[model samples]
Target: MRKLYCLISLLALIAILCTGAYCQSPRTANHQPALAASNDAQRTADAREGQRILMWAGWIIGAFFVACTLYLAVERRRVVASKDAELAGKSQELLIIQEQVNQTNEELMAINANLESIVEERTLKLSKVNCELDMFLYRSSHDLRRPVTTLMGLVEVSKLGFDENTAKYLFSKINDTAVHMDTMLEKFFMINTINHESTEIGEVNFEEILDSVQHSSLVHNYAEQVQFDVVVEPGIRIVADPQLITFILKNLIDNAIVFRCKDGKRQPVIRIEVRPVGNAVGISVHDNGIGIAEANLSEIFTLFYRGSEASKGNGLGLYVVRKAIEKLNGNITVSSRLNEFTCFHITLPPSANVQIQTEAAARPVLITA
Candidate 1:
């Protein structure tokens, strides 16, 4: 635009200079008047033509400058509009990202809350276990020390030179105490194995397992007055850990024999039954025994819990049995009458797809006749 203005100014200056030169040209004193007049007129006509041409050139240049300015304005508006649209798009994207971040934070907070609840529950359980362990230690120490002390005193008395019959009675007492201590220690070892050792799962033959347990119990003095009976469903087969199952059955059966009714009106009897329940296996050990009191039923499975003076047990048998059942993802329920009978029913999942559910330690149940 500046260049166009400068060009118009230069053309005007040249026209003015030409006019002045023409006027200043020396009028020849010797020239004829008519010829000089004619030359002045021609010179004026040429100057007029040149002035018109300069004016037209200036107008054309100005029009071009106007068109260029309008073009530049339109292009600038288009560029500004494009930039505004792009900025708006970026802002929308940022808002979406912010929303997503907020949602994620809320979800994380929920998860943290749930985790805190779970941790609190676990901590309470651990505290209870610790307390139980302390009790176990005290009881174990007392029980173990009493038998040892008794044996030592008996030995010292025998050293004083007793007669034959007296010596024989002393020997018998020593043997009984020693046997009791040995049984207690064996039970402790079995508990340790249940906790640390893994058992293999296989197809178990219940008839064979039951027969073996029955024979072993009889040999071990469980047959003095009680008769054992076994009944298994025909073609009954199960997939499970054989050792664990046998241990459970043995413990229950032994408990039955140890706590049998002593009235002797009719011989005490233990009945074992195995049958299938749905997709799982069901085994029941029922015995006519001096049954558990209702008040003490729930406490039976607790470690070292003794219900009465007649309980000639270390109190680990039922506890170990419960633990074994838990390992197999099974459940046990005890139903008993005060003097009639006591029965333990166990339900076990199939070995192929056993799903272990987290459960608190087992507590026994009592049933009235």
Candidate 2:
């Protein structure tokens, strides 16, 4: 639309120029005859009149063009002012957003600092609590043992003065209760002393440990009726605390017998196998008794955790085993099927032949008299 208007304006200007030139050219050609007389005056007047009309037309056109230009300039300035105002408003908004971002960053930094301080405080408190608990357990268990020992001795003395039948019943009850109390206290003492202790790495014969444990726990009395296979190769010797190793095996064997199947048709079996792992020995106690549920296997080593279907126990056997194994820098794993079988794999470092000989030489003499 603007292009068509400009083109028409240009064409009108060209036509006016051509008309002015043509009129001037004719006047110039007839100049001498016209200017020598009165007729010259008339021609001059006519020329002045044409000049006046042309000047008036030029003034009107120039004024119209100036008015249009002024109106366009005013409109352009208004548009520019409006756009500048909008830009200023956006700039203010950006400043507010920047301030908000800075505030959020400051809050985040403060939160992180607070969290770090909280973690440090909790860690120190936890360490102190653990130390206090260990000290308490050690002192408490030791203090309780004196009274329990005195009571057990008195009971034995009282048994000798009474009739045989009455004394037997009373003595049995007293022994059982005292033994249970001692075991509970001993467990606390064990937990307190077991951690961070240096392990005595010696040649631990699994067969010997099993035999001693069976004799002591009376698991062998039930073993006669059970068809269990103990497959322990003689050369397998693990590096661990010998007494602790015996304790662990005794607990495992006791658990096996405690949950033995009572089915008359299918005979119960408990297989104890020791195999050589790299730089260690793997002793597994596999029992075809009342197997543990899948969910209970992980919790079996937790202190005082007894499963729903488990037989009555203090639930410290596996916990004790784990503590002892950890002291020896070993690990234990478990796999089980419900009512089918359960296997516990304990891996411990193997004692070298030189260390075994050294241990043998360090034995003390016993006075048998």
Candidate 3:
């Protein structure tokens, strides 16, 4: 547009200069008066023509400038609108990003709070464990040293040259002390083994397992004072760790025997009954024995908790029994009346059924009292 305006201005200036030269020429001044007059008229017409061309050129240039200005204004407005739209879009995106950041911060805060709670819980558990450990150490040391100290005192007394009857009594007391120490050590070892050892799962023959336990008790004279009876569903078998189950049964049976009622005229009876319960097997060791006191029942399973003053127990048998039952995913519950009966009902995992026999001999067998 500028080039076009410049070209029009240059052409208008050339026309004006040509018209002035024609009007002011010296040849025209020397011409006859008629011819000079004629030349003046022609110069006048050419100047008028040049003036009209200049006017048209000015209008054209003005129109061209106006069109360019309007075009530029429209283009600038379009550019501004595009930039505004882009800015608005970017602002929206920034707002979304801010929201996401705020949400992330909230989640982090929640996680931090939960972590604090978890840490507090774990600290309490650790403190409790530490206290229990301290008590265990104190009690275990006392129990362990008592028998040794008694044995040493007895030895010193024997060295003082006692008579034959006194010597015999001292020897018996020393033997009893040694046996007590041995029992305590054996229980301690059993507890350690149960805590550390891992046993495998297998098909367990309850009849065989119960028989073995009964035979062991009999050999140890546990059955001598108590009438033993066993009633089990025939061919009943279970899947569990045999050693662990055996340990649980043996401990319960032994407890029943040891705590039998000595004052009753009738023989103390320990009856074993087994049956199926849902997806599990139930075994109850019911005894007409000196039952546990209600207040002591809850603490019976605690380590080194003794119920009776006459109890020869080191107070680990029930604790070991409970641990062994847990290993097989089983549970034991007790119901008893003081000096009448105590029943330990145990539920074990599902058992395997290998056969179905109906005869009395093949059915659930009862041990003859």
Candidate 4:
């Protein structure tokens, strides 16, 4: 309807332009010269006037169409610009959403890495727990069961009829069995403690620790019979767990004492030496006692391993020693001569400084029997 109104208005403007052009006549420099012309010349003048009116009307219609075309082009330009702005706004929103997704992906990757680390740590702990459980089973089946069975047998024998001296002998045997069982129970507790406890490193005084072990019940009984020549470096600083080191030393020293030769040929001498070896400490525990055979050298550190058939120990001592040394990140080696002497050499990395002396007799400390 609007387009029809526009078309009608344009036609009315064209008609008005043609009427105005028809009313006005063309004028020349000569005033009445055209009136004096003949009949054919007057007709020619009238034709020229009509042609000029038609040209004027055509020019006016062309100008109106040009204006309408320019207005339509401007409106089209405005619509295109508005659509471009809307498209640009949506594109910007998409970029922002993409950045947010990338940030979320990064956070998820970090969480996955943390979870993996946690799983690895827990797996290690579980594996260690399983190994300790196996050890417990071995002890219950072998060490604990034997001593208990022997104790029960001895108690049953005590009830049998016998003379006074025989009864005394049976009582003594029963007492020894009971003591042995008690010792087994103590060792079981120690093993459990060592298994579960965490190692604590600190400054270690080898001489002080050695002195304390000598006074302890583990070796005090043989103090007079066996001489302990402790030769600790004058100022050796060792960083290790005192309990772990003490356990290792105590077992080795007790083992040396228990395996002393029965022959009364030479005095039992257990010499202990502590010195620096580069970044580690070198320890020598040598005893002049019944020695181990070459065949048992490789198996001495194993659980419940005894080098000699006549070994009175429950066989857990050396096992505990090995475990403690491993915890301290140390290594031990043994060299022995039958019926002569047995020597244990150990190297332990202590996280501290050591005072090394080139001279062997700088400050010699000797304890003789």
Candidate 5:
């Protein structure tokens, strides 16, 4: 393009120089006749006309070249604009990709934080379970050994010759020890059953259950002296593991009988009430027993927690009660005042068609001595 411009410029310059030469050549000529001068003047006039034509041609060519340059410049600007638009689009895409990457990173960070929190929570739960298991094992071994050792000693004493009355007394003591051991073993069995067995949820006849419990060996002897007042809501059934409910009731009733005040100030009475509390069956076992002291309330439900010196239990009754209640997705709360009365309230939730309760939990209690 530069070469073309230079060529056009050169041609214009040549046209201007040729016009000047033609206009001066007539002046440089020697003095001549009028006719010759006139002829020279005529040649000059023709040269001037030719110069004008060349000049117009140069001007036209220059104008055409300028138009072409303007067109080329416009085309160059359009190409640059197209390239700028494409680059701008790519930059926008890059920015969007960066934003997406940032969002992904943020999500990953949040997930990581949540996982950390979950792991920490699980670790704490595992630690607590381990501690409880250890405590359970230690206490269970000691309790089992104590009864076995006593029975062994009793057997050795029986081997020694004794009077008939002494023999009877020894045998009776032996029988009592054996019964206590059996009760402890049964409690252990229940514990194992509750822990290992999956819940077999079904409809339970509360009335039939009450009849059986009242007739059981554990309650029959106590019934002779202690009054049992049982009030069950009519036509009400419980949807739960019957065995678990039976276990819970059996323990509570037994505790009511065993822990009764023997001072004879007030008659020993146990009131068992079953009624509906919201969507669940609420069972309350209240006894006018030598009730729990205010201080022992919190420890009563702990494994191997023996709240009273008069307690003949293996210290697993209330613990097993709580565990069984939890297995059935129930809640239990205890209220007691020393030498007055003790009340244990239990709420059992249905397994299906309703939400189960969180767990067995005691309320603010004045509990066992």
Candidate 6:
């Protein structure tokens, strides 16, 4: 492209030089006869006419060059205008992109704010649920006392079959049993209203809790004939809720006695043990009277589930037990064989920092988020 421009400039310079040389050429001067001079004058007039023609030709050529330069200038201006229009279009597109980005940022901020609001709302809902659960526990505890008192009276009346001396001992045991039930009911309510912030954890004597449960159940006539053999290590102190722990042990012992099969041929036997497992305490209740079927195992702790043609219960006892264990942040597992044996292993944390295990396949873990 540079070479083309240089060639065009060189051609214009050559044309100008040729035109100057033609304009500068001098005319000839010499002596002449009258007729010759006249002829010379005519020749001179003809040469002058030729020079005027050349001058006109030069003007026409100069005009042509001017016209070409103007054409080139107009074309260059058009090119510049087209480039400016293209740049303006690109600038408009960039503005649109910037506006879109700003709008997207605003929307994102709005979404983030909504997410925060949802979190705050959920926290308040959880607080409300905890409050309601505490209220339910108080109501249930108040309601349970009426029926339990009547049951204690009935047990007293049932003692008529025995002698007076035996009756007196039985009444003492019965009264103690009622006291124990009352205590367990109090613990049951505590379990239902468990809060990490509200619970007090200290040295819990597991052996004593178990002994009280056994003695209490005997007073209630639930374990009159069955001999309980507990093999728990004495002086074993676990950091847990004493009331809730006692309630858990009571329910387990009660369930063992209640689910005993009337295998007309054999007597009821139940074995209980509390042992340590990898820094955690495991309390197991084993019964030889009656065992549950595998199919009914998973359904045992559902809200009001019951086994078919097997045992009878209020259906909430085990559910309450499960909730109590959860209050302690512990785990419970059960394995049973029909008409043979059943074992329940309750594993508790050594202290307050117990890992709570979820057992949806076994029983529901009752806890708040």
lDDT top scorer: 5
Over 186-242, each residue of candidate 6 has an lDDT whose tens digit, in order, gives 545544565433566655775577667767733257555676776755434466667
> Per-residue lDDT for 67-92 in model 3, tens only?
76776678778999999999999999
* Candidate 2 lDDT, 1-369, residue by residue in tens: 346447656865875686577446544444576556866676788778778767876876677567667766787788899999999999999999999999999999999999999999999979866875675557555546755776777678885687888787777767766766665666665665665455565667655776687676346568576555666544544445677878678788878877777776567777777665665667788888888989888898876667856565666778888988776667899998987888999877633321221222322222110
Worst 10 residues of 3 by lDDT: 351-360
lDDT of each: 0.78, 0.70, 0.77, 0.76, 0.81, 0.69
Which residues of candidate 4, in runs, are more than 4 Å off? 1-136, 161-163, 352-361
lDDT of 4 by residue, 1-369 (tens): 348448956795878666666545464534465665654475576667666766766676667666666666777688888888988999998989999999999989998989998999899979876885687687668877887788788778877778999888988887777777876676676677678887776667776788888986658878888878888775566667887778878888988998987678898889988877776779889999999888888888776666786688777887888777777777898999888999999888653322223334467555543
Better of 1 and 6 by lDDT: 1
1-369: candidate 5 lDDT, tens digit per residue: 567667767876776677666655644465567678687778878777877877787788678778878967987799999999999999999999999999999999999999999999999989977887899889888888988898899889988878999998988988888888888888899989998988787667656787788887778877778887777665565556788888888989888888998988888988888777776878899999999998999898887889899998888889889999888777899999988999999987765522333334443222221
Show the lowest summed lDDT stretch of 10 residues, model 5. 360-369
Question: How many pairs in model 6 have backbone atoms within 3 A of each other, for residues 3 or more apart or on separate chains, i.e. clashes?
Answer: 0
TM-score between model 3 and native: 0.63
Question: How high a TM-score does candidate 5 get?
Answer: 0.74
Q: Pairs clashing in candidate 3?
A: none
Q: Please tell me which predicted candidate would have the highest TM-score against the true structure.
A: 5
lDDT of 4 at 301: 79
TM-score of each: 0.68, 0.50, 0.63, 0.60, 0.74, 0.48
In candidate 5, which residue ranges exceed 4 Å CA deviation?
A: 1-103, 234-237, 349-369
Name every residue pair that clashes in candidate 2. none
Q: Give the C-alpha lDDT of model 4.
A: 0.76
Q: Write the per-residue lDDT of candidate 1 for residues 250-285, one digit (tens) a residue.
A: 889878877888878767888887766776778899
lDDT, candidate 5, residue 7? 74
